[model samples]
Target chain A: MALEKQSRAAFWVTVLPPTLWIAVFFLIPLGIVWAYSFGHNEGLTGVAITGTFDNYIRAFDPLYLQIFGKSIAVAGLTTLLCLIIGFPVALAIVFANEKMRPLLLLLVMLPFWTNLLIRTYALIAVLRTEGFANWTLAWFWNQGSTLAALVGLQPFPAYQPLELLYNNFAVVVGLVYVHLPFMVLPLYAALDRLDKSLMEASLDLGAGHLRTLFSIVVPLALPGIVSGVIITFVPALGAYLTPDLLGGTDSQMIANVIERQFKRANDWPFGAALSFLLMYATFAAIALRAYLTRGQPADGHGI
Target chain B: MDQLAQRTQDAAAHKPIISFRNIVKRFGSMTAVDNVSLDIMPGEFFALLGPSGCGKTTLLRMLAGFEVPTEGSVLIDGQDMGETPPNKRPVNMVFQSYAVFPHMNVADNVAYGLKIDGLPKDEIKARVQEALDLVQLGPLAARKPDQLSGGQRQRVALARALIKRPKVLLLDEPLSALDAKLREAMRFELSQLQQKVGITFIMVTHDQDEALAIASRIAVMHKGAIAQLGTPSDLYEFPASRFVADFIGSVNMFEGTLIKDGADEAVIACPDLAPYSVHLPHSAPGSAGASVWVAIRPEKLNLHKNASEPPAVPDCPPAHNVARGEIKEISYLGDSSIFHVQLSSGQLLRVSRPNRSRYEQEHFGWGDTVWVSWAGSSPVVLLS
Candidate 1:
């Protein structure tokens, strides 16, 4: 690209800082990790450069592969749920009048103002056993039991607090809650730019509202849907905090296993290999999104 | 039979296909349409002509069931459409943007309405082709909307709406997006297409020329109410109000007072006509000594070389309804010439003459003394 602005020298002046920063802080560390993936771990915090495939072969063990499969399924489910819930929210925002539109959009993005760690903690308060979910249910059950006793009927059984936290369900819920904005922003961008007359034309042609939503609105929003699915799925696949904080022992994902390899297991080479695999999978998701949107320009999904 | 006779025959023969009764639409404090009562006959190409913000499109949308009127009921074939949605209503619209689905090809777009109704596959296929062929777009069915030209896209929209066999077809500013040359071509195409389909076509357009060229009857709307509704010739030659008269075409107006109101004729006395009084056919809706304005089209006024030479009327003097003026400016359009003459009373009047042959007529130049004249029936006096 030609930098034909106020000055040719301004190109280097503005670009050099970010390039140097990425090179020094990001790409260089990533390159070191990549180099360590092939090395053999020597004794006492030293890794010798041996260039062996032992770490990669070990990564395909049934245990690691099972974790990988479970991670994929969880990420897929999370992305699907986000899309199912986000599409309507995006549509609502797009159809809202001018005065209410920006305010509704702000509500969708308000969660990001607080840190993700705090928001995940807040969710834990809502979903945990003896938390708000169980407390509310217990209150309803008590009221029903009291009404039954007063009406000359057998009293209901004792109330039991349901287990909602520390399970696969909580992990999925947490991931969906975190990544919903990723799905909604792109959809809102696409749906807002749509020409409303197309919907009117479809209705005027004798198609009802549901038929027009499928035939006209959904197909036109395909690119944004694909973008949202890819971004949300990739991030949820590599999520560490959500699964670690909310998942049960049987629901450990590939990310938690990679973290164990780095910390408790103290296997640096294996951890590096596992993290690289996760990075490659992320790359694959982005590449698929690019292939889907080949002829169209990659639009900015600003929240 | 003549056009007006056929229209009268149609009215006497059948009930109106679509009727709008006392339609009033308001958004908050702003009234968009105020008590509009109109009936569209079967197979008539009726047009709503107005300037922008005059609520023409809003009226069309109400008929198509897109906008619900605040105080009216729309009817189709004597059936009251009180709560009918657009999909249930037997009307389709061709949008101003020509909202052909970008994701679908021309064939799919044309087949959309039939497919939604769940017709048989073979029948849908056959009908889609026929509709495309009607718009002369048979070969381009496989192309998407983006691949088509503006006129071709518009034709695709037409075919898509027509395949439904709706009782009434609505068009909103159909040709306003095309270039001038393409618009002229499509004007004939749309009128011919309407005749072929034999469906009642209600079109909303701000262009007076387009409405006059195609519509059997035109409603001129102003400020949320119709100013006049009449046949094209009636609207052109004898507009009911000064707004209608000034809007349709260019005309010269002179303030006058009605000197005499005879049975079929009235004499107008004006300061602009220092030596002559106007002998109009008494069209100003007022009595004697009432202030009025005399309107004459530029082409209706005649020019003569000398002040004493009378115009086309027999046995009439030149100065009777004629005034002497000097040619202030001359504008030469390709086929005709417009002369801006300054009368002896210092009132400016435009006189247009057709250039019948090459270099043969009495051409008036700047600062030339000329006498401008018009027959008694040429001018329509207005109250405004």
Candidate 2:
């Protein structure tokens, strides 16, 4: 009985540190947010717990609703783009020869060595007007005209730069660029563990490359896909930095609105409420992902 | 009369279902399969038997269109398969892992190939039902592959491959994943299923017993080349080389030299035991004075306490074919007991005796002096 008691004490000793850390850092801060969401605000600075639903009601306002919808759209589009671009990169790394695989994975993760803010700024240099994109376009346009004169056709007109930066498109581009490795690493891990024999069996069973890719590879890699979407989508939903630097007035997401509430408008309760709203949505996505991938085996377990 | 004549002529002109012509596969500096040629007959259950890295699986994969030969060609039904993709080939394979699709249930897995062929919905449903019933998995068609046991998953793989009814079916170590009892059961099931379906099956396996039990003909491969190919009994009893003789089953080998190479019999002189005489299997491949190894099966050698036992050869002395040994160990298998006897020449010879009687006439225990002997036809001469 004394030994059993000692083992129980040992178990709690091992578990105490991380539990205390989470309780202090995460649960306590969240409780503060939840309590503040129900409180009434004093003039400019003070807060008191009157327990009203007024802040939540204001969260459903048409202006805020529009911001939420736009945030969802931007996050959804960014996730879709990441999946589209990152899946092929992951597959290439998985299927590459042994000597080249490490180099390719290193390149995928190399972006993380630098600060994301610096990377977003670097994208600005390439995406702004009269930047590298338009210069390349102008060079191609000049070449088209030169070739047109050489062929004795009509001469083409000069090029003008496309409006490429400071919009929703720029925000999505920045988000996708920043979070692509997040999408790829999980997918690469899942695909690397997949049995190559299953792919061969698919082909031997008369599935073409495209059909096999859709039916076998994607479904077998569903857990990774779910986690990749979660990793990319949740952050993209609550994104503040990319939209702040790359977005204009029309392209502001909910994070920008929440930022205005706290730092600019000095409405801390409303900002906390909006922050909880985003957290609730992310929680729902995580729960749905858990429910969907509950029984999925990480390694390919079947034919 | 006309129908019979035409049928006989057609049988005479029947071509092989698959053929490998001077095939060679090389990976960088290493040759995986070297100058291999073979023809698989229609409806014949063939096996490629070898140790790991002997290129048996490489040969099987080349036939499945997973690997193309570096030199020469592969022909299926007399058509060149060099440029054909795996999905376009008229062959299906059951992988060693049984490669069941994890996402789909059993019925969907069985119906996959037919669905890809754009078959009508009812036909596919009926075929899937039939295939599942064939594997006796009709009741569990809705269960996922992970939910099934190892044996059930293997049956699902079989059902899926057989549903397509391809010209050839390739199995790569299909029974290696099952437990011992399940492997034996599946071996019987595989042989019976092959006979029932009448589709050509070419299996690659390292288990010699499995190949012997299921295959109509076996090809024993060594280092990317076929060392011997024959029926199981021929390979077991009249093995052409030392490798085949030792690989197929346990044998007592005596290093010897051919003393007399005659048309009717060949005599081998060994320092251990007695001079061995083997009834030559027509046209044995060696000359007089050539070094050879004499291999004799354990069951062929009879153990006795004395040389005065009756019904023995009266023309030759018993010492010419007998050796004196002391029993060192006894292994009591249920059906038979094997005795490891140490000869006076320091050779350990294994002798298997059946436990035919509940009360034996005599019991031979360890440290008993015994005489081990065989007839002239029992030993096979291996030249390699």
Candidate 3:
């Protein structure tokens, strides 16, 4: 009995520090946020701590509903694009030659060295009308006109650079670029652990490359794909910087609205309420993913 | 089954199904398989037996179209498989790990190949059921690979591969992952299945016993080359080289110089034993005074307790090959025992004897002086 007690004491000694740290830094802060979400804020009367559901009730307003719906749509699209682009890149890295693999992975992670804000600014430079994209477009237009003249056809009209910045397109492109590594790192880990013999067996059994990829490789890597979806989608839903800088007013997301409530509008209670709504929506998405896959094998390989 | 076996044998007597002609596979600086040329007959169970890194698997992969020979051609059914992708080849493989797709149930896995060919749903289901029944996995069609035992998973792999009905089936150490008893059972089952299907089987294995039991002909490989290719008994009883003699089973070797060479017999003189005369049915490798090894299996040696006592028989000649030794150690296997005897010349020799009649008087024990004798015709003359 005494030895058991001693073991119990030792266990506490190992577990207490992290436990206390989480309680103080995470639980207490979350508790404060929860408490703030129920409070009422009256202008010119300073912040009041009276508990009410007004803030939450206002969060479901049609105006905010549209913003939340748009947020989900954009995040879903960004996640889909990241998957289509990053999955192949991760598989390529896994299949690369031994000596070149590390260099390719390093290039994938090289974007981390630059700040997200600076990267968004750089996107601005290339995406703006007078930027490198426009220059390339004008050069192509000139080449087309020269070809037309040589062919004895009518000369082409003057080149006009398309507006490629400050829209939903730019917002999604920026989000996909920013979170591609998030999608790829997990996918690379899963693909790297896959048994190469399975691929060989599939091909030897008369499955073509594409069929083997979809039937065997992708299904086996579903865990990585799911985690990549979670990592990219959840963050892109709450994205602020990319959408704020690269988006016009029509493309504003719920997070931008939440940011305004906290800083410009000085509605801390409303901001806290909006934050909880976003958390609940993200949880719902995760729960939906889990519910859809509940019948699958728990080992992450089931259909 | 007997009819199927006869039919397979008749088919094997014809032309080869797959052939590797002067095949060489090199990975940058290292040669994995050197200039190997072999023909695999249809409906024959052939094994490439070797230790790891011997390029046996590489040869199998070349036939499966996963790899192209660096210098030569791999031909299938008289067609050169040059630049042919794996899916285009008429071959299927059972992997060492079984490689059953965990995401799919057994039926789906078995039907994967058929699905790739875009077969009708009913036909796919029927073929899957038939393949599963062939492996006796029909009841487990709904079970996933992860939920099955190692042996069951192996059967699923076999079913998946065989459903394609390819011209050849490649097995990469297919039985190595199973436990010993299961491996023995599966070995017989695999050979029987090959005969029943009448498809060529090419297996790469490191276990000589597995290759001996399951293969119709075994090719023993060593260091990226074919060292010897023959039937199992031919490899065991008449090994071509010292490597084959040692690799196939335990052999005691006596290094000696050939003193007498003749058409019927040869005599080799060594310090470990008296001038050993080996009965030869064929020509010897070198003339007299050339160094060679007299290789003898341990089980062939008879251990007698008294060295000086002659047999009671007066007509028969005395033991021609005899070595006087003291029993140093004994290993008690369930059905047999191995006696390690130290000769008067201090050479340790292993002699294996069946432990028949448990209650009988003990023949030999440790510290007992004994005479190890064999027939004059038993020793194999190894040139290298």
Candidate 4:
């Protein structure tokens, strides 16, 4: 009995610290959010302790539903664009000459070394109405108008420049640029581990280049592409800084709405409900990804 | 099968199936394959035998269309394959690793080439079944490569390569991955399969035993060049140079100077062994004052006790090659004994003798004085 007690003490001593840390940091915050989602909102001051489902019902309101739909659209677009530009670049990097591969990989990751916020702001500097793009447009218009006037014809009607800042297009561009490396790095690693003999076997068996790529390369690389999509899509869905700096009310995402409810409207309970909905959506997306990729063997497991 | 053999016979009657005319392959500053000219007859089992990095695989790859020669050209069926890509070539290769597709089953793997050619589904199925049956793998048609044993995977690779019905089949060390027993079994199986298919078989291997067992003609490669090309027995009996003599099998080489030359024989005084005369078709160049080497196989030297009378010499001449030595060590293999004998000049010579009986009845222990002798025409004289 004494020896059994001593062994039990040793086991608990080894596991207690990490268990306590997880409970305090992760479980406690999740419990607070779950509790707040069920409480009632007070009159513009704070939340009341009365248990209710009113906040959950209000989360599905049409106005908020529109923001949810728009968020999905923007994130989906970002994922699609990243895949289009990243797959080829990753393939080039993985199969390049040994001496050039490291240099190419460094070039791909160069943007991440700088401050991410500074990189996003740099996009604003380039795409703003008075930025380099507009300057070039203005110069083209001036040249065309001068040539028309010189030919003894009336110049084209003057047009005002359009605003590009505070829009959904700028937000999408920022998300794609920020998340592209995430997509490319995983893809490069996956392609690097693929056996070269598999491709040769396919070719020797008389499959053309396109058939080999579609039937063999794509199926083998599906797991990597799925992971890349998840990495780019989940973060873009809940993005706050990009939408806030480069989007107006027309482009407000669920994250921005939650922020408004907490800081501006003083409705902490409703904000907490909205946060729970976002969390549930992210969880559902992850479960769907897992179901799709369950058949793929883990790295180094299958042939 | 008879029809295929007849077709192969007809093809051989017309022209060579594959030909390499002064082929050379260079990678940057390194020359992997020098000027190699060879012709492979149809229905013939030809082997390119060499050590590693001796350009045998590179030569095989050139024939497979995976590589193109930097100089000269490769020909299949008298048509130059200078610019033909691998996919368009009428040849297929079983890669050194087998190169079996992990995602594909045996039947699907064998049918891949026909499917790519857009054949009818029924025809593809029938041909796949036929190929699998040819390799005796019809029962395992639905299994993936990883699910099969090493020998089974090898058959699958062979089936996949042969289903295309190419003019020639290239095997790049196909049995190198099998265990010793399996490798021996597959060597015989591969030879019988080639006879059944009746297509030209070009194999590359470093194992001399494997080459001699399967190949009708063998090309010994050294330093990106063919040292000698002949039948297995021809190469074994009359190796053209010291390289071929030493590479093909175990040989005891003794450096010597030619002392006299006759019409069909020459006497050589070896610095390390007893003097010997070898019969040849032509006298050695610079016969009287030139250096030469005599190669005698270990099994050709006979070891007898000193108390026993020496065997009478043959009609050609007396026992020209004879030496007296003391047994230094004896290795008692179950069926044979390998005796390491130290001669009077302190050179150790190895002689293998059959046990022929129980160890207690017929055995040569250590530290026994022995007489070793050979006939005049036993050793081959290497001029180079």
lDDT of 3 at A21: 99
Estimate the TM-score of every prediction.
Answer: 0.93, 0.92, 0.92, 0.87
How many steric clashes does model 2 contain? 3
What is candidate 2's lDDT per residue for B1-384, written digit by digit as tens?
Answer: 465476457546789898889989999999989998887778889999999999999998988888999998999989999968899999999999999988899999999999999999999999999999888999999998888999999999999999999999999999999999999999999999998899999999999999999998899999898989877887998798999999898899998878778786566677776443333333345898898888999888788874444225434444455677899999999788999999777989999899999897988998998878777768887889
Residues A44-95, model 3: lDDT tens digits: 5466767898899999999999999999999999999999999999999999
Error of 3 at A277 (Å): 0.6
Clashing pairs in 4: none
Model 4 misplaced stretches (Cα beyond 4 Å): A1-23, A42-51, A130-165, A300-303, B1-13, B274-286, B307-319, B326-337, B344-346, B355-361
Off by over 4 Å in 1: A1-6, A297-303, B1-9, B270-277, B281-283, B305-320, B323-330, B340-348, B366-370
lDDT of 2 by residue, A1-303 (tens): 999999999999999999999999999988998888888779768988678888889999999999999999999999999999999999999999999999999999999999989998998888899888888998999999999999999889778888889998899999999999999999998899888888888899999999999999998888889889999999999999999999987999999999998888887788888999999999999999888788655453443
Query: lDDT value for candidate 2?
Result: 0.88
Give the number of the best model, judged by TM-score: 1
Off by over 4 Å in 2: A1-13, A149-156, A294-303, B1-13, B274-285, B306-318
What interface root-mean-square deviation (Å) does model 1 yield?
4.6
Error of 2 at B18 (Å): 1.4
Q: Provide the lowest-lDDT 10-residue window in model 2 chain B.
A: B275-284
True contacts kept of each: 0.82, 0.89, 0.91, 0.49
Better of 1 and 4 by DockQ: 1
Worst 10 residues of 1 chain B by lDDT: B310-319
Q: Top model by lDDT, which number?
A: 1
